[model samples]
Target: MENNRAALILAADNSPLQVGPGPDQSSPAADEVVIKVAAVAINPSEWKMKEFSYIPLKYPHVLGSDVAGTVVKVGEEVKRFKAGDRVIGHCLGLVYGGAKHGGFQNFTTLREAVTAPIPDAASFQDAVVLPLGISTAAAGLFDDLKLQLPSANVNDDKPRDEAVLVWGAASSMGSIAVQLAVAAGYSVITTASAKNQDYARALTGGKHIAAFDYQSPSVVGDIVDHIRSAKGVKLVGAYDCVGFESSTRACAEVLHELNGGGVLPSVLVPPEASSLPAGIKAHIVNAAAPGMVAGSPGAAVWREYVPRALANGSLRMRPEPEIVGTGLDRIEEALNLHKAGVSAKKLVVLL
Candidate 1:
C-alpha cells in the first residue's frame, strides 16, 4: 500500500473545497483497478452538490467525477486490463456518496466495468472530457430515446435527415449531444451564444445547425424557423442541456410547434409538470441514477455503445483542455470557473 494526499470537503454548504492529506492507498479489489491519475475535469454536479448539499456529505469527502489515468495495478481476477494501460471513465462519485476523493487525487480506483481504454488517437486531457458527456449522451440518445444509427454501407440512406435540436449546444454535455445525434443519422439544430457557433459547427460536421444567443427574445422563434425550413418535422426530438426556465420553455415551445407531437429529453429537472404540451413527452435524464452505475443494466448499454463509437471514430473527442491545474489546491478555482460557465472549452486538473 502507498500513502497519497487528497483534497476533501469536511462540511456541507461550504463554497471552498479543503485540501489536505488523507488515508494511504490500498490494493485494488479483485475486480477493481488502481489508477495513477493523470488528469481530471470539473463538472457542474461538483459545485451544485456543494451549494445545495444535494448529496449526504461524509466529512473529508472527495469531490470530482471525470478522470484519465494510467493503470498502475489490477486485481487478481481482472482480465480485460493490465498495468500501464491508459484509461478514462466517469467516476460514480454521486452514487458512492461524497466520501471518495474522486479524480482530484494523484491515485484512485474503479471497477473495470465503469472504465475503457482511451482511444490511441486522443490525448489524456481530450479523453477525460468524454466519459461523462459521452455516457450521458449515449444513454439518452440510444437507450432512453431509442434513436437508430446508420448501417455499414455508405450509401444505404436510411433517414439520416431528421432534425434534432440541442439547447445549450456549447456546454460540454450539449456538445456531446449534438455530435452523437449527428452520428446517429439525425440532422442537428442547436442553440448557443453567437460566439460559440463556430465551435458547435466544428463538432457537428458542419450540418444544418443554428446558434442563437440564449439572451435573445427571438431565440425560440429562430429555432422554430429553422425546423420549419427543414420540412415537415415528424420525428422531432430535443435535448436540453441547460435546465433553466427560459431554455426549457423555449425548447418545449419549439418542439411542440414543430413536431406537433413528440418527446423532448432534458438533463435538468423536468419542465413544469402542468405546462407540458399535449403529444409531447418530457424525459428527465439522471445520468448518475444507480441503474447506470457499474455492473447495472444501464451501464451495460453504455459500455456496449460508447466503446464501439469511440473505437471507430464515429464520435470525436472535444478540443484540448484549455486550463490544467495541479493537485487539490487548484480544484476550488476550477469549480468556480465551471459554475460561472465555461466558454467553448473544458478545464482540467493534473493530479
Candidate 2:
C-alpha cells in the first residue's frame, strides 16, 4: 500500500482533474478487494459531478465509476476472488467519495458485490465499458422496469410478447439496456441516430429489436404506431437511458399512446415532474442505490448475473470504447470529450 498514484480533483466544483500521488493503498476490509486498475472509462456523470458538485463530496474528491483491473489483494471474508484475478468493477468514488474507491487511481478498492471476473478473451479496455453501463441498465430493466431476469442458458428461456422502448439506444447505458431487455425475452424498440442503427441492431442478442432515428420528426408517432401495430405484442414499459426532458417525455408519450395508463418508464436522470404525463409513472434509477446489501438487486447483478453472463457471452461490452489515450493524464481530456457528447461510443483510457 505505498507509492500508488491517482488523478484527483483538488476542489469541489470549478476544478480540473489533476494527476499526482494519491494516498497509500489500504488493506482490504471484509467484503472488499484492492485492484491495480488496468483501464478506466469515462461517463457523463463524472464531469457533471465535477461541475455541479451535486453528490456530496469531501473536498479533493476523485470521480470515476467504470474500472477494469487485476486483483492485488482480497479481504479475509472474500471467497469469490483472489490475488491476480482479472476483474471489472464499478468504483464508488462518486457515491462512496474518495480516491481509494475512485477509478482514476492506479489502485482502487472495490466492493466484492460490485466486482466480477472478466473472461480471459476480453481485454481490459473492452471490459471496462461494462461496469457503469451494465449497472445502470440492470437497475432500470430488472428492478425499476421489472422485466424478466436474463438467463444465460437457452434451455431455461421463457418467451414473452411484450415490447420495451429504449430511448437513446446509442448511448452507452441505452445500448446495454437494449441488450438486457432483449436477453430478458422482450421485443425491443429503440431510438438512435441514423448512423447508429446498425450498432444498435447488432446488440439485439438475436431477439426482435427495432431501431428508429430519434431525430426524425415522426419518431414518436413511428414508435407508437410500430409498437401498437406489432402483431400479438403489448407494450409493457420503457427505459429512457437519456433522461433529458425530450427523451423522457417521448417515452411517456409512447407508453400513453400504447395504453391509456398504468405503464412504467424508468429514466437515468430524473425528468421534471411537471412534464410527465398523468398516470404514466416515470422514476429515476440510481444504479448504485442497491447499496452493497447482500440480497439486493444490485448484488444479484454484480455477484451472480454479470459473472455468468460475461462468461457465456450473453452480456457484452457494447458501443465499444474509443481509446482516448493512455495514462491518468488523459482522463480530463477524455471526460471533456464525453461531456461534449459522443454517439454510439464510450471514451476509454488505458492506465
The root-mean-square deviation over C-alpha atoms between each candidate and the true structure, in angstroms, is: 3.1, 1.9
lDDT of 2 at 192: 84
Question: lDDT values of the candidates?
Answer: 0.71, 0.82
What is candidate 1's CA lDDT for residue 245?
66
- lDDT tens per residue, model 2, 90-119: 887767637678888899898888899999
Candidate number achieving the greatest TM-score relative to the actual structure: 2
Which prediction has the highest lDDT against the true structure? Answer: 2
- Model 1 misplaced stretches (Cα beyond 4 Å): 23-31, 75-77, 149-159, 208-213, 289-314
The alpha-carbon deviation from the true structure for residue 207 of candidate 1, after best TM-score superposition, in angstroms, is 3.6
Model 1: per-residue lDDT, tens digit, 11-76? Answer: 786757777775444667676777888888888888887788876766777777888988888889
How many angstroms is residue 162 displaced in model 2 relative to the true structure, after the best TM-score fit? 1.3
TM-scores vs. true structure, each candidate: 0.86, 0.94
